[model samples]
Target: MLIAQISDPHVRPAGQLYQGVVDSNRMFEEAIAHLHALDRRPDLVLLTGDLVDEGRSEEYAEARRLLAKLSIPYLVIPGNHDHRENFRTAFADHAYLPATGALHYCIDTHPVRIVALDSCIPGLHHGHVDAEGLAWLQRTIEADREKPTLLMLHHPPFTSGIPYMDSYRYIDTAPLEAIVRSVGNIELVLCGHVHRTMLKRWAGTVVCSCPSSTTEIALQLAPDAAPASYLGRPGCMLHLWDEAQGMVSHVSYIGKMDGPYPFA
Candidate 1:
């Protein structure tokens, strides 16, 4: 199984730029084009969050239009930037985005189980997985242990070691840790909201985050670092899974650049 992950497009109502720097709409289109052009098309496209900047109905509508170009099946989750009601209203026809419940779901994809958990807290930049989401996650993972599971959510459960990002990471992680430790089948925990590629480990499972399609956050390695944002390269993550080889995840940036040739 192959999965293409796109995060935090932050698309506006009319392909408008964000903060006069990020062309989110165009970047999203380029990312989709890159996905389609891959040698092996993905089985599914998992959009982590922040599909829109403000979660407006128009933004969702616009997102729907942009996403329609992709031939692969896809699923979306709400981020701190997204409005839950708007998400439901926009994706009413989708079987996964129901009109009710916690906005969290568990999907069984044969040898692989994809669990989309809602970690967004209303009116806040940071996020957390509440008790309800935690319970659902625990039960679902406990029920299935042999299958390779990939947990997807908008907020990462661990800190990215960056100043601005670490402060806003999933606030309550004890329960999350317990759940992950008990599950044993969780191979990868995928998340967004940081707007940069990050790798971490939690409960023996690999935690990975992809860069936003629109913008990239500057990497800050020092503690007590100031909140500094960047206009770095836009990118996404591609996850390849196989029964024999296990799971492989890689990062790809969106842009045209020439590479040095050894022969030349």
Candidate 2:
């Protein structure tokens, strides 16, 4: 199975630029086109979070229109930029999602079991998981210990060194980390709030944060650095999974670039 992970498109309404600068919707469209053009089409796609610039109905409408072009099936979780209720209403057709409360569920049809957790705090930029949400996650993972599981959430559990971005990082860590550490079958904990590709060995498994489909948050580690992002080369993560081989992730950069010149 091949899964494509794209994050933080921050799509704006039609004819509008995201943050009054970059055309994120068009970039997201290109990212979808990129997925379609791949030699092997992805079996599934995961939109990590921040699907729109704002939690407006129009933004979700535009996002829905652009996402309709994707031929592959996809799953979405809410980010701080997304309004929980609006997101739920926008993708009401996705029966896997819960009708009320947190947008959390488990999918077992795929080769890997996907346990997506809702980490958004409604009206806040930071993320948190209440006792009920955490308990749900623990029970969901415990249900299938033999299956290769991928835990999906919007915010990364660890504090990224990036000063500004870390300001809005996930707040419920200790308990969550304990839960993940005890789960033996969790193959990967996938996240997207950081907007840049990041990897870390945590809780007996790995956490891979997908890159943004639009602008990338600048990699500034200085404490005094200001919050900023740039219209950099957008990209996505293609995860190839096989029963024997496990999973190997490759980064596929979007837009035109240099040729596939032979290194040999």
- The top-ranked prediction according to TM-score is 2
Cα-based lDDT for every prediction? 0.86, 0.92
Model 1 regions more than 4 Å off: 259-264
Question: Roughly what TM-score does model 2 have, to 2 decimal places?
Answer: 0.98
Cα misplacement distance, residue 36 of candidate 2 (Å): 0.2
Model 1: per-residue Cα lDDT over 1-264, one tens digit each: 889999999988875787667778888989999998888988988999999998889888889899889888888899989999898888887787656866888889556789889888888878888787788888888888999999999998887778778777788788888889986789899999999888887888999998999877778789877876777788889999999999999998887778846785
lDDT of model 2 at position 33: 99
Could you tell me every candidate's TM-score relative to the true structure? Answer: 0.94, 0.98
Which candidate should be chosen as best, given lDDT against the real structure?
2
Model 1 residue 259 CA deviation in Å: 4.6
